[model samples]
Target: MVRGKIEIKKIENRTSRQITFSKRRNGLFKKAHELSVLCDAQVAAIVFSQSGRLYEFSSSEMEKTIERYVKFSPDYFVPGRPQVELYLLELKKEMDIMVKKIDLLEVHQRKLMGQGLGSCSLAQLQGLETQIEKSLRIIRSRKAELYADQLLKLKEKERELLDQRRRLREEEIRETLVRPMLPVTLHTGKDETGSACRMSKHSSEVETDLFIGFPATRL
Candidate 1:
């Protein structure tokens, strides 16, 4: 008679649970061994009992199988290689590139300082001379431009001084022309009472001895 399928649930009785665990674990190991031998496939199994007993079987070395699983499985944890390792590798590549560039720069600097002339061909020497001449020309041109700017500033200052002097001289001449002249006073004679008489003279008139006599004595 075909038996009904057993309900897949935990065995409640302690003794029955232990018996079922032993039988099922041995059967699983037997099937794994047969599959490995018949199909030439690697198989591994692990069982843990309620009493904390360990049971494990492997077609090959347990460590080797676990290592292979880690290599092929996407969810396995790998030691010694993490996200930080990728960053470190990229950093090392950049450092290598920088070192190469530094070496190249040092060589170029040595060539410029005339320390390694023996390795340079005639064409390279000519090129170096041309580059130096171009750099010198550029420097001299900049220097000349600075000198011209300074000379222009000095010329502007001199012109300002000349203009200031001219303005001061013109102001002086204007003040002189606008000034008023004062009249001259002269003592002409004494009166009969002994009081001296004075006369105002025009600034343009000439003095004469005829004006020195007393007015009463004069006609």
Candidate 2:
């Protein structure tokens, strides 16, 4: 006999809904059991009736299967104390590792600062000395490089200033040479009436002689 498909909707009658729920819930649990047996898998099913009755089935211990699910399921809310304890244990391990690393760093820092030397072995002291010497060499090399760069910059600045001063001096000399000279008048010896007379009508004809020899020789 061909059976027609039933339309899926909420049953209107309470008795009919109860009967349907009971039959479907039993079928679902049976299918879960079959799946677990056939595939050698863990399966669980939980249902609550309209009257608030709880029904559950599990391939193994119900608690163990649910705990496993919680551990593996990303969206599952873990309300169990055992899971919280496991998380605390993991957090403690990470904190212990971080604390150890911090202690090691503090010890190394103290050694570098030349403190707490009494606990260090001879080899450790020697290694620290070598590391310090290397660091000093790096620092001194960097400082020398900086000094050389500063000296080079100062020398360049001095050269620029000297060039600027020379340019200004040359410009001053050019301006002096380009300037016009003022006219100068000269008087000749007095005439027969003992009055001074001009040597020429214009200053251009006036002869101002120049002597370059010693004064005694000229006399």
Candidate 3:
């Protein structure tokens, strides 16, 4: 039969309570004895029943174990000192250290802003000046680099604009070169009967020669 897990509470029945206490007390003593023998450790356990029955177990003299514990404990420990007081003392020391660090940082900040010169030696002041000068140089160099980058972008944009203008001019020139020219025709006056007459011989000859390329140059 599987036994149910025992709930950790005060046993109500007197008979069951006594049985449980007796069983647990023996178990406790057995565990202490085993722990001492296996681990080579000193162990002590003491318990009292509600009816003033005493139960005790110890691997060595219990008084000697207790004396060793007290001896190894913190020197500042006392019989009535609360544990919270020790924590509070540690916190106060840490707060003092933090306060000192904050004060030091504030002084450094003032020095960086040129406000703590009164306490600085000549060499310290010179070092501070050098540091500031180096920082200024770095800042100025970075600023110049930024400006140069912007100038380069502007120059590139200018070159792009120039190239676009040149391409447009070339396109315009090509259009002009490819344009068709209109033919010119001369008007001759009509005769009295409103009928067209042949041009004068000289004029006809000149027109023929001009239009036909000098009769193909007989020579």
Candidate 4:
């Protein structure tokens, strides 16, 4: 019968899968041997059963063939350590950090996304303006209080200085008032006693220029 195409995957039937594994493994080793003999070449083949049996054929020693496979296989083999795996790990780390940054940026963008600055109603804007004005007023009040306190201090200092100046002037006046008297000059005229009294007194004389009975030095 012309059978329909089968999907190229593992057969689920246990007996059929074992039969296929045996047939394919034998065919693969037979082809490897023929090619090695006919072309006068080195060849190696290794196969593993589903139950962990290792089958191998080689033109040279099996161990030597395995060593060559490990050194030359490009897909899964690496010498000592894998540089490609280390690079992939570093790339994964960078991608993880980039993902976290993108998440944070998304959250920030959501917070500010819909604030249409030009679409707010006039009353709402006015309220905001009023709030700002109140804040400014409070600040100005605090500044005025500081200015007033400074002015009060300056005025108190001014009053103190004025008081000190007044005290000094009073001291000067008192000292002047208690000073010794200076010599006097007089212009005499005719008195009520019908005499021209020229009043003068020497320091050694008696205090008797008896026109009005007041001493000339006292006058």
Q: Which structure among the candidates has the greatest TM-score?
A: 2
Model 2: per-residue Cα lDDT at residue 126: 98
Per-residue lDDT over 1-219 for candidate 4, one digit per residue giving the tens place of the 0 to 100 score: 999997899899999999999998999999999999999888988675775455778988865665566567776476688645565476467657666876766754443443443655778567656766897899999999999999999999999999999999999999999999998756365564424452433334655545866545653
TM-score of 4: 0.31
Better of 3 and 4 by lDDT: 3
Backbone clash tally (model 1): 0
For each candidate in turn, the TM-score is: 0.43, 0.48, 0.43, 0.31
lDDT values of the candidates? 0.79, 0.82, 0.79, 0.74
Q: Give the better candidate number (3 or 4) by TM-score.
A: 3
Q: Clashes per prediction?
A: 0, 0, 0, 0
Error of 2 at 210 (Å): 50
Tens digit of lDDT per residue, candidate 3, span 125-199? 998889899999999999999999999999999999999999999999999999999888555665644334544
Candidate 1 Cα deviation (angstroms), residue 19 = 80
Question: Quick one: RMSD of model 3?
Answer: 26.6
Candidate 2 or 1, higher TM-score: 2
Candidate 3's displacement at residue 210, Å, is: 47
Q: Report the candidate with higher TM-score, 1 versus 4.
A: 1
Worst 10 residues of 3 by lDDT: 206-215
Worst lDDT window (10 residues) for model 1? 194-203
